[model samples]
Target chain A: MGEKVLMKGNEAVAEAAIRAGCRLYFAYPITPQSELIEYMSRMMPKVNGTFVQAESEIAAINMVYGAAGCGKRVMTSSSSPGISLKMEGISYIAGAELPAVIINVQRGGPGLGDIQPAQGDYFQATKGGGHGDYRLIVLAPSTVQEFADMAGSAFELADKYRNPVMILSDGLLGQMMEPVDFKPHKTEEELEELGKQHYDWCMHPNEDEPNHHHHEINSLEIDPLVLEKHVIHLGEKYDEIEKNEIRYEEYNISDDNDVLVVAFGTAARIVKSAIDELQEEGKSVGMIRPITVWPYPYKAIADRITSKIKKVVVFELNLGQMVEDVKLAVNGKIPVEFLGKVGGILFTPEEAKTKILENI
Target chain B: MEVIAQRPKSLRDIQFTYCPGCTHGISHRLIAESIDELGLRNKMMGVAPVGCSVFAYKFFNFDMAEAAHGRAPALATGMKRARPEMHVFTYQGDGDLAAIGTAEIIHAANRGEHISVFFVNNAIYGMTGGQMAPTTLPGMKTSTSPYGRDEKDIGYPITACEMLSSLKAPYFIERVSLLSPKEIIKAKKVVKKSLQFNKENRGFTFVEFVSTCPTNWGLDPIKARDWARENMFPYFPVKNFRDKSLNGGE
Candidate 1:
């Protein structure tokens, strides 16, 4: 076991990112996520890394794009409105197939909705917000432990798929503190080796060979035929990701359960508490918590659901954003219901239990 | 045998897609020639902004990244900071550096990031077909401004050199022209100096070229050159606004 430290979700994620070999970070100050950038500013200089507090979110995302192109492990974080400002650069990074990590500590949105936690950015994260046929490997973490843990895995998956990875946590998680055991960090020698692995494509120049030439990180494909092929190739990669990277946690899911609950991020944590209370009362309620929201554990949901289950309830802090995915997974096999608390107001376990009882 | 000018090895054999009478070709050759003269072919990195120069990655033999419009300076800042050993620069057009990317250019210059910027101000959006640019002249008739630009409605063209020179951080800032042979000779010297300063790790350097776009301007190549000299030179006034070396580079 690693050393356990009580840490806020934001700072833990930032520290874990440094441990995972992120030597460069760029960000603009936004509510609920400022701790991450502040922590980075102090620690990065100590480790001889860089932390650039950019003028705006647009500039910050572009800086990540530039640093990532040079084969550096880089990151940036923002809230809902700031992520909207970063959309163009995000799309370009995904289109260029450069590896980067973006943390969207989600707050209320659609237009600076509020400073509190909300899962309103679900569709934007999973469906590729910016223009183009691309996908972000979105990880929805419900606990500070998972939030910190996803930092390392996020960079690993980004490099493995050559795509952007998003840590989509909400403000509650960002501000809350919990004891988390961190993973072992990458050494400077390991990071040096990682740089050598990207020699074929990084922007730091390359030797010209029969099949090799100068490196370029670009998203512009003027030729339609060439672009079509590139999009198809991206689709193939997503298909492989869906096959290999579906992560979820099943709680009290058995044949005896009549109600199945689906949720992710902060809402999932609430759902788990509600299910535990309901189970104590002898009510058969189970929960399925999605870890990878983009590759979304559809098979896990489909597999656990049987004729014995009478209702599938989806809960969120937004106006029914993730319920659509739950319905798509349920596929008319059972009645799917939604319960939402909007405007950044969080629902407690007791409130969630009431809603679960009403829906059933 | 009398030796004629041959293409620089720093430029790839790819043909430029620039329109006739466009000064992008001339500007590219100047950059390419400077790269060859300094022996920086393998150590050079560039960021191409989204404009007529978006495909600049295809012309230069060195590694490059295509940035979101006006985001080239931000990208170059990242590259130079990450790999301080490499020489980094950005090639941007008017609509890119002045219009959509105004904030990016200003902040990057203010930070004094160690990178060079080559800005081409042709007063119109060339790739998107003759729209009004922030550098567009008053009374100029572009596709968007068919009845001539109104300085009252839309403000006058920004003089980037003058604006950037006011900042305390920049190491060098110059506005040059490409209208005539004499201007081109002087412009080459400035471009070479920017590249040299970059190699020396001298801080943020910017060189703006008041260029011509005959296709967008609805003029012949020679007439476009004449129009630029008459209109652009008066407003932009080819001059060096700031150079650290002017005072022995403190």
Candidate 2:
């Protein structure tokens, strides 16, 4: 393990990405995530990497598309409104089937929302925020350390699937500081190997490999039949991803539990505290934290629905997003409920415990 | 028997989809020839915009990327910055570059990104049918302006070369015409020089081709060229706007 260092969540993500062999970083300044772009700006030059403060979020995402099309590991970051501006380019990246990473340190929003942490973009992130049939392997991290770890995982998943991956963080994680031990940075040879992984399709002169020429990195298939085949092919890949990559943490789960609390990210951390307090009171309550929100760990949730569990409750910063997923998992087997705080308001641990007690 | 003319090595053997007399074919040939002459066939990469040349990726024999409308410059910026050793260029039409992508083009030029831009100003959106364009001349009839473009309501055409040359970063900025054989010969030189400068890693080269759209113009190919010469030539006058090399490049 590398020596531990104190780093902000945003900064840790940036450092972890560099260690993961990302040499091309582009982004526009947005609140809560500005530190990430700032960190890249200061460090990219030192590592002989490129950092561009793009003119707009739209430009930054397209720049990511351009670089990733060339088989280089690239990243961009923004808050909510900025992310909305990036959806168009993100869709293009997905359609082109290029590996790129986007960090959305979410702020509250439907429009010009406040610069406070919020989980309102859950639907946008998990349900293919952009247009058309596609999915970004979305990773949700509950702690700063996990935020740092997920950076490496996000890039790997993106490259493996040849799809865009989003590290869905929020204002709390971005602003919080934590001690993180990043993995060893990739050596020059390893980075070179990473670069060559996409040589078969990357946009290059192909001078050394003569038979490969005119590799077109594009999403537009003019014929409807061809496009249908392509979309179905993408669906098959997504199925493979769902099969192999669903991740979640089951905490205090037992057959004696009366309530199965479902939450993620910040809400999950608060829920963990609530479960701890409940256990002290001789009350049996459990919690499930989803690490991958899209593949969703639905089967995991469904399998844990014991007869002793009277209800499944969901906690979120938004009104009720992930609750729907929990309901789908519970599938009428037990009563499902939702508790949330919006507009940047977070449910306190005491408040979470009270909610869980009421459900129990 | 000696071969008089052949397709450039940089161009694929497939037939062009351009309509008869449309200058996009000529422009593509010039670009392909430039890539061939400079021996950048293996090194050059192109970004095709979302217009008539949207299929340019199919015709070019090198690695290519098709960008979202008006976002080609931004994509080129990403590619060039990621791999500075490789040469990149964007092919955009009037609607894609001047109207929708104005910000991307201007900002990319302002940053002096090391990429070549080939702007085709045909004065109308061809693929989407005849609609008024940012480069559409005043009092010129288009589908969007069936009664001729009204100067009061629509405003005059944008001279891309003049506007881009206003920036300090571009190393070469020139507007060329392809209405006649002699003019096309001149345009070829500009295209080659632009690519050469790009190959040399000179920053931000731009070339605007004042071209003809015979199908949309409701004229035969020859008449369309004549009309462009009579109208567009006066508004978007052919000229060399900027050459930083001539003044000792930074």
Candidate 3:
């Protein structure tokens, strides 16, 4: 039986990371996500784990890069602006094919926007924030419970693919309190076994075993041919991920429904609330929430679109990023409406309901 | 069966990539020797910084992670925390640690992370063709600071040992030079002690070695040593800034 306790989304992420055998956590204190780092700081000591308040987001991300390079489960948390500072290291981690978890408890911004919840970083998180042809497995958690659950799944996916996985939540998810049950903790021995099976590229100590070779973890290759080859290999891995890891949730989509609301993260939560109100008022409205933003539940959305859904509305906290993907999914069969607020203004359930009614 | 007067067992047979007269080789040997002496060869992991020592992972036989410039301390913090049973350290150069990664190193020390940091301050960015580094003396000229580093424009050289010593959490902080053979011996002792502290699961230990860049300084190896002593030492003095062990009137 799973035990449930009331916890904030940020606290649940921290607790789940610990339970998933994450012993190294480094982060800089930023609003919204500060609670996550604070929780880790208080909890890491009790579990014989380590929590470091890094000097900056750049430092924190690099710290994750280091721990990941050594075949250890590690994580770092930040808001939008802080995550921006970490882009360089994130690109490096992706290039080196290191498995690490990065949590972006997104707040507003192209700059120091605001502390309010915003999904403006969707393009950045899903489309590679840094300069590279790399894709992070971006997970969007609609509820506090999923935030806890995804922490373990994120680590598992990272280790499996040797790629960085980002939990792309917004300030609402980071700040909201809800019931959550922590996963069972994995023993050190179990983690060691897992690490050995997956991370042969890791820098484990080379002693006694003469056949053991040193591994150099670097993302640099001046040779264009070699770089092209490396990128191709990464491309193949991405394709494999796309085929195997697409996840999404369809809520109340049926042949009777005409307008379909598309959303993710916090926007999805608002959309769900709107859907309930719309259904109560005798309006046919439904929502589709994309859990994995990169592997992007395209198939599910396309399947729904084929079943007589006419109008689609994409709601986001950005000017229009995820709408493009929605359009691609709809393939001109339906008109895609975009309702967005940039620089940290979140859409309210009433506002979404109003938009849905107008569209209908 | 006693192993003495020989190289550390922790070090591999790989030849160092550092240029001749580069103090990084000596510094690396000192760290490896310390790891060996403490019987931490098998349990030690190191984060190698970018710049001249970027390829340090190839030199160290133990597990090593290569980090971007200035991020070594942050990386070391993660590794040390993730596997407390393993000893962790970061080998960094002036440009990597003092310039870009200043925040990471300072905060990690301030947090009193159970890791050792071996900082090599050569006064110039050697790997990147003699760019002026944070540790470069005020009047020193480099590729970037062609008109000699003007204090008014570039600010004064950062004395890392002095800076870190001011932090409360760091347990050991020392500035040593590797100019002469005698100084090399002293530098090795400091490096060893810092590693030993980490092996003993003590708090943050920092050893700043006043290193040299013969190729970048456009000086021959001997002249570079002489130049470092005449110019760099006066600005960045070599001394023990803090030692928790010496707090008791020893």
Candidate 4:
């Protein structure tokens, strides 16, 4: 922690990216995530990084694909409708095994829903939004500080796996301002070390070398057998990711609890408030707040289930997307219930409390 | 046994997958020769479009990326912006450039991004079985335009060089033909000049090669060239639209 300063979540992510030595930023203007791109536009020039306001979201993500192919730490941010346009490029990036970070500052949507907070992109982020057998290591941050921190963490995860990582945030998180402590900027030498990590496979000039080799950043494999093998190799990586990267926060979880609540992102924050009130009223409720929603903390939710726990309940901003994950985790051992609000509205703690009590 | 001409150092020894008599082979040779002639072979990176030239990554003996349909310019923009010191270019077909990727090509040129774009206009989509392309002639018949293209329905052919040159930023824009031996010789100079401009960091160099799709056009190699000269040349005339260097004072 260097110093605590007040910052919007979107601006904090931009600052964190710059501090983490991400110099290539390409994006289009969208409502909830515009501040992220706007911050990069103003700051990238000062740091001598490249920033382009691309023609559209599709172009922006493909630009990310190009930069990432060269082993440059690149990022693009978009809202929901804009993100739909980017799926084609994201699929290519995943198939090419390039390391890139995407920030989806989600607005409400099936299509251009509204410029308000919603967790509707949960399926789009964790499951494949793009056409492929791939997953984006999704980090759902509940607070501005976590949102800022996940920027650096997302880059690390992307590089570690040589896959794309998405920081799934929503309008409420993007617009909210809170105190945040950013890590120190990476030194010149550290940035150089990071750049070298992918040189063995990345596209770069090897002209002067005795053995000049070429690198192709491509995803098209016409041969079905070869593609099958490649997909299986990707599967192995996903398995490794699943084994090592499942992360969640357990709040007041114990055997004595009557009901277990599952939620993530901003919904989890509201649920925590509801749990606090429930405890005050002599009712015990615990929450499992998933941080990494892809290698979803399924076992964590399962292991915490004691005989005393009556039922499991899920709360979300969307019309019950994560509830499916909750049901899969519960595995029919316990009854699972869900309560959700859609169309850019967030359920209040009182509403959450009533839902939890109903499940109890 | 003196070797007067051998393969260009910038191209691999592997065989091309293009259909017999397709001008993609000619276009690849010209680009490879241009990179080799400029001595930028080692520092060059190319982007392959999602068309007949999608396997261009395998053909070009350098760093390359294959972009999605109509998105090669955007990909090249990213590559150039990432490695400003390294030379970058995109090899795109008419459908990839003029049709699906109109936004990307226009914006890349308008921004004067430091990259070269080689647009191959054969007037039809050869990879997807001769469908009508944005550069298809008004009355040209193809798989999609079975009854000949109607201007009211499909619209006129896009002259990419003219459209791109109208922008205030591109440093070079030229359209050349590979319809005949003499035209090919002329096309090579334009290709080399575009790469030279790229090497010199002259912004957004573009050259559209009026190429032939012999197999798709149901013509033999010789007749395809003759057909292109007769049918394609009038609509997509070979000309230099803009050259910043010729502007005298910038």
Off by over 4 Å in 2: A208-212, B248-250
lDDT of 4 by residue, A105-216 (tens): 9888898899999999999998999998988899999999999999999999999999999999999999999999999999999999988999988888775556787999
How accurate locally is residue A68 in candidate 2, as Cα lDDT from 0 to 100? 94
Candidate 4 segments exceeding 4 Å error? B247-249
Error of 4 at A293 (Å): 0.5
True contacts kept of 4: 0.85
How does each model score on lDDT? Answer: 0.90, 0.92, 0.86, 0.92
Model 3 C-alpha lDDT per residue in residues B6-123, reported as the tens digit of each score: 7666677878778888888888888887787777877788888889888788788777787877888877777776667788888888888899888888888998999998888989
Question: Lowest-lDDT window of 10 residues in candidate 2 chain A?
Answer: A204-213
C-alpha TM-scores of all predictions: 0.98, 0.98, 0.91, 0.99
> Scoring only the second chain, what is candidate 2's TM-score?
0.97
User: What is the RMSD of candidate 3?
Assistant: 3.0
lDDT of 2 by residue, A151-212 (tens): 89999999999999998999999999989999999999999999999998998656633574
lDDT of 1 by residue, B221-242 (tens): 9999999988998899999888
